[model samples]
Target: MSRPNILIYMTDQEQAQVSFPEHPCLMPRTEQFAGEGVRFRNAYTVAAHCCPARASFMTGLYPSRHGVYNNVNTHTAIHRGLNDGVITFSELLSEAGYRMLFSGKWHISNHENPCDRGWEELIVSSPGDRQSGIPPTARWEEAAKVSNDTRGRGQILRPGWGHYLVYDTYPDQGPKGYENDRDYQFVTAAKEVLPDLTESDTPWCLYIGPNGPHDPFNIPERFADMYDPDQIALPPSYHDQMEDKPRIYQRQRSQYWDQLSEAEVRESIAHYWGYCTMMDEMFGEVLDALEASGAAENTLVLRMSDHGDYCGAHGLYCKGVPAFREAYHIPLMARWPKGIVQPGRDSDALISIMDIAPTLLDLADIGPIPEGVAGRSLTPFFNESSPTSWRDTLYTQFNGVELYYTQRMVQTQTHKYIYNGFDFDELYDLVQDPHELTNVSDRPEYQDIKQDLVRRMWRTALAEKDIISNPYATVAMAPWGPGIAFE
Candidate 1:
């Protein structure tokens, strides 16, 4: 084992497409970063939301196993924290004599910060806002106070009240405010600590999480100018009405995003692309710092996101209740000069954020992770020699975001099946409908495919001890039973 120094730079709500060499979101530096390593073209999040996916990266366990089915923040949350004694990879690495430094957003829990998991926390975002992100009940008077023109340009109204500012510039910060942006601060923290870690003899781990390319896409005027709305084309699937899918999906679209005009959607996408480029530029700084310290050869740098955002695909802005591919698929790239075999290569192997913990342990020769962990080591793919026996089917669990919906997704190379506990199921043949324009769940011809996918779903749920299989009569609403795990 090379025992490389680990550096992780994570961005929030980044789309998987951004990692592609031909993506419209022009990120030369990020592209350079990807070229220096292996890009897992098929990387995905265990869950779509922030906390649950981040938790999976930390523990290498599914949300059901970690007891964080949804956001663990101060927003309409069912759980405010993780289950007791959840072992994070950082804890193991710290014990293995690694200096753990964390900067930027730590959305895993309100009850505890990264410090609790053996990290030396620094310059983090929303560290201890013990309140839920969404309140259980809204103030009627405040809702009534919203401006009469709720769905006007730039601002959009919710299903009824509450105006949401979609995209705009920082009013008070002017054009240069981006210089002091929180993302800049996160990078600054990383730069400040890199020197000390480089000089130290002990191996170290540094995590930089920048909050960007998330909701609203509010960015600096300079960055926004990089993209033109007129030139930006909405995703081909953006016109999907979602009529063939569940009513909840339609309701989510019609209620929130429908208010935005097509032009506005294009503008939002432009802003999102600009945001990605901004983060990419900041990331280049960290890369520069690493090279300056002369530890680039032995450092394992992981550039990825907690999850992805739908930057106007299916008329959705942020990731949530919708069981769409845009929400689950995330950009994942890894670079370790001494450890990685094929530099600047891409692997289509199905990878999960949860795979990070186990892969790091494996490369460090830290040996077996705790029992019941779900992720497999990505060392084979890193070596450019993926074993023939690798998994062909990938599964994702999404209990909810801020809003609750029991959605389980099982995707194979050719098809995708989504079991929406709240509504009817959805199935899409990726070969025919890569954009997911149609739902063939009810087609008789697709019944065989649906059945096979459902059986696979139960296989993962049963293996992970996922409690969603409660078949106590009234709640056992899945089209297939847990018995399918055996059948």
Candidate 2:
């Protein structure tokens, strides 16, 4: 029997709050996949931003260890991609005689193309709004201009309050009409190549990356109108009383959320959901192609997102500043019928997206994961019995971007503490304030709890040799409370 093929479907900035058993309106194919597999309830991204999070997925190391601190494409200060010295899971898979195919957004490395990273057939999308010197709406127009298969009538650029620009396609033809969209193009490319993959003798790994539901809050008309904007409910933390929180919390709210009226916020969220539905349709197309090509039976399929969007949570729009569950927690699900005997169960495992690499290698039986890799193999969790040594806490770090901020978060099942190296820190009693509206870090009553978390964070950083140790170690390592200074 041949080795199991690996199929990874990744989305940019998709939050766990939307997929299956959460927001059930969209992503039917995704929901079906989850029904037949294992879903990780508490999977998180190492960093809240894009580039670093994607880098972490590629290499099993944190941002500081990987040496790509900020977003490479957007940040001028960071020119480095995944360090040449680090060995990626893909490199290991390639060496094991697996054929690799990559299509869609390749943001992991700036200088080296995906071809250099073990992919045999690479179809890279046009650079996004930030990279291209054009109106963000031009992305849609560029897609239409280049593809005869696209049914998008035209691109719509609607300017809102604070000069907020929305990019969407005027697709009168419904979901199938978005064939010209970037994600559709990417999935179509994958579908076209599936036949050859099934016929080939060697096992294959196909990585599908789509940039959607991330921003611009624009999608084809069919999807945008799928849910009534006025009927959409507000986020639980919509009215975040910013009292006692870090100064950046209020600043972020004022900068990003203060400009929108209630109606605009609703519409923006509605479009975001629509974009997710569009992505769902595209995902279905790829899944259909896989089944049609007879490769679905032997394929180990995984779907996950790099970080998440705020989606009006805490009165915020995009990711940045004061990391929280809305931005850091992501959705991770995997389905491999042959390897996983028991499916359709939710595992509340404290796992990081960085663990994906080693997990895939384990499934492929590729063994002896390279040295210096900081992630753990998730193969055991796929079994019926939970590992007694499973981790209880997860650590996430962010080193500033867009707004220039630094934050370290240590989270457990009940409580969470964030150490913002810039202005102030935040602590949340998840049981009391699940939405994380109130910051109890500076509160007198929670001082001891805060100190204990800080000590745990310091010890974890020391044991793990986290990169933030260089500057903040001396201060964080000192006698707990007095050293860090709560109030």
Which candidate has the top score in lDDT?
Answer: 1
What candidate 1 gets wrong by more than 4 Å, as runs, is 129-143, 150-152, 159-161, 171-177, 401-487
lDDT of each: 0.79, 0.72
What TM-score goes with each of the models? 0.80, 0.75
lDDT tens digits, residues 1-487, model 1?
Answer: 5588999999998998986888878888889988988888899999888888999999999988887777665334577777886789998999888899999888888878889888998877867554444421233224435554535666665321345667876642544446778888999989988888888788999999999877768888887888889998889889898888767666556646777888998888888888898899888999999999989999999999988887678877677567678888999898988888978888888888989999888877786688778998888877765666687888888875432357899999999999876566799999999999999988999989998998798778656655453321112345555555555
Residue-level lDDT tens digits of model 2 in 5-33: 99988998888878857674587888898
TM-score of 1: 0.80
RMSD of each: 12.6, 13.9
The positional error of residue 72 in candidate 2, measured at the CA in angstroms, is 0.5
Query: Residue 92 of candidate 1: its Cα lDDT?
Result: 93
